[model samples]
Target: MALFYKSNNAGVPIGWIAIMLALLASMGGFIFGYDTGQISDILLMEDFKLRFATCETPGVVASCDFTVVREGLIVALLSIGTLAGALIGAPTADYLGRKYAMIVECMVFIVGVIIQMTARHVWQQFAVGRLVSGLGVGALSAAVPMYQAETAPSQIRGSLTATYQLFITFDCISIGARDIPGAGSWQTVVGIGIVWPVIMIVGMMFMPESPRWLAKHDRIEEAAAAIAATRGIRKDEAMSHPVVSKEIEQIRNHVQYESKMKGGWLDCFSLKDKILYRTLLGMSLQSLQQLTGANYFFYYGASIFQSVGIEDSFITQIILGAVNFFCTFGGIYVMERFGRRRPLIIGGIWQACWLFVFAAAGTAVDPEQNDSIGKLMIVAACMFILGYAMTWAPGIWILIGETFPTRTRAKQGALSTASNWTWNFLLAFFTPFIVSAIQFRYGFVFAACNLLGAVVVYFFLYESSDLTLETVDQMYCDPECKPWNSRHWAPAGYESRHNLVEQTKAAEAHKPIVGGEESRREDVEKSGDEGRTERC
Candidate 1:
């Protein structure tokens, strides 16, 4: 555990271009956060309920009845749709390339948003719209991190990929809608959703496809250009830049090795190299991330506080959103400066403590009888949120993004993401009933889950903080490596602990660049023979 601090070295800088691409791809996450966040407020809106909520007094906003089942469906259907979309998004990313897959998902989101916006009165129609829109969000969620992890430099990959979750927590615009009731057509609020996806659709045109995706599909020249773009090196100089050459070599070796091996759900679980254990590990972590209970606040924050006798629940949700938004930056900073394992383990325990306290303070005393108890509930909620935002929220994305091998990255990442949405759907659908039955007592269940998550991390999750993506694959490939003792582990033949930094020092990877422009290949090949590239 002490070695954790020693492994937090920054490896190599790729360039600003990769960061820009990651941010642009993260627009999907922004859209996901905003659209999902607005629903909590919209569900509380009397006008919104009058229009779409099934109610006893349909025409009268004051006397309207909001049934829990209908309310849950409006939120849950999006998760269901997202689950389906995530499944489809993976193969689409494999077939169409990450850039175009991004465009496709954005378009899908737009169509769903239009459906939700234009719904005249039926809640079912709106739910259908959510399902449609979820397809896009689910797909983009799968695609964005894959794109970021594949493109990013290793030392910063966790931070960059975790930005997806950062954008997911950016509920600023939507959370503010509660106070702006008279601003415009509330129907058009869903229409506002299209703006994010539209921006991404255009942005993808200028961005590079994931170099790994291009290489996997055998588009070698384009892959070289993409690697060049990410590194901010000239296309002709790409094969000569040691970092670029080594990355291409790694990608090529992985794809080639995967070609000779059988892959699928069956093979993935064959236990030949503990692939099944790893697969389950990734997906289970994603599922556990959702089960950590932060969504309880985001999805139903307004109602949760209102139940505690807070008149202005929107203010509290906004407070929570602000806390979530800011803590994500700390999460990014800590993951890069401290590595992944310690923060996640510590965060889980921190969250468990607050969750237990929150549950006790909320349900242990009658908040209705004691004003101080209600206030304490809010404090506990914020602290619990603070832990979630800084740890499991961002950590899972970075872990899964870098965890799976390139061979199974798209499909396996899809399964991982879909696992998240599956739990999301269950929570969205069942939370109302659970709350009605136990109210704040629900926190205890999540508290237990968080405590379990820490144990799981300690026993299973290896530190992937600064390892190159392929080097991570190499870590899992080597049977000698142990998760708990991997703090100083480097791949075979590497002097430096960080594989990416070793590449920068002109270490040889498996092979030279091939099938790019002949001149570029010749330069790279000649340099490979000379034991280093001259482009640097």
Candidate 2:
């Protein structure tokens, strides 16, 4: 019920510290966005062509244009690495702790940057470097947010974490607009992408560990200390609050119960129907975000502009990047105030409309006609970015983190994140083929996907804003929460074992009839020292 930990004083300056740390840590996402957007410009470069030139046969004069195949291969290789990393990152995060996982990812990222920056051969060595960097990005996408959310106070959590998405949008815009004014100078753009990971390594060096992770490990005193240090509170003062202490105890208990309930992969499949549905929904949303072809705009906008006969195509890529950066701010500003559902609904409809307009422009407009159609297509692309920036891009991650119960949160989050990467791999890998088959008219396919996604959101997704974690679980499990079944959403058929109301009542009922309160207090004092504490 309390908004913040008791140890947090009325005027404590910890909020700013948390925000700064989160911003720095979230640079990983910026690196991801930069690399993704940089591809558009990279492909347009003559150097890109020279580096990847292929021979017709061994020692024969090179016949295949290296530029075209090389660009596609680099992008595809990165996506493949990301797919592999996403699957690996989840279990690593759960086992090694989020901070350590990030440290590992940062090292991998730096190595990739070095290889890419210095590489001469584009075949085997270039692919290795791209894959390494992609691995870092894939893991970082999952680890950074999890770390930030666990460290943040619940009150300002959404805003602080949303910064990750904000930075990514900005990075995309920056990469698109960045130019070194040479024909084969895309290396400058690639170098710019390295800055984010460097910032992440330095920022994370000073941040405190996640209190929730400590608590889950049954290290109560260490968790308390982390909570205090991160929030700038005294340890005793933090532990003195009944609500804070209770939540800590609950986390510890939940983790212990999970250890006892551990089973094989089959057990994960044996979960209740509601659990399965929620997991699938989270995965579906993540996949849908990619399938909508948003990345095509981010990764290939410059090429698209060139196809439309735009002058200074790289400059247009930069402008599109700027649009992406600015519009995503709209999503961040309104996320908490407007809540999740409204933005998603509105954004979805907006995206569908913009996609249709874009498709129509591509279908109807001639490249030689007055330059008007090209401008119109540009506007439509900006609108699509606006819609995604505001809704599906960041909102899907938020929903995934908050949807599952604590017992299943890590595993479900991992599975959902992996699903996203797998679909992302497909999109990035096959985009070239799609564009080749459909020509520059791939906008129509994306428009259709957006329409389908909007329909899915309308029927399946529910309002989640303003609800506590327990309330969300109940909403999904209770038949009354099923659409068209209840006048008002509530837990209907399922027993509320983990419901806050029931948990509180049960806790109260177990209060000793005679001197039980005193014993409970003593137990709390004794168990406080039995918890884990580790410093990186």
Best by TM-score: 1
lDDT per residue as tens, model 2, 1-536: 11232211222124355767678877877887777766655655555545555646543334435555565677778777777776677777777777788888878877887788777755567677889998888888777777776776544556667778877776443334344454226667777777778778878877767766776677787776665555555657767644346546545654564466553334445456366776777777778878777888876666557655766755776676677777777766667666666677677778878888887777776644636777777778888887888787777766765676555666666667778778777776677788778755787777777777777766777655434343455466555465333224433221232232332323322322223455434433332232211000
Model 2: per-residue Cα lDDT at residue 43 = 56
Each prediction's whole-model lDDT (CA): 0.77, 0.64
- Output the worst ten-in-a-row residue range by lDDT, candidate 1: 1-10
Candidate 1 structure quality by residue, lDDT tens digits, 303-373:
55765666675676678889999999988888887788898899999999988987898877877777788
C-alpha TM-scores of all predictions: 0.89, 0.80
Clashing pairs in 1: none
lDDT of 1 at 181: 56
**In candidate 1, how many Å is residue 355 off?**
0.7
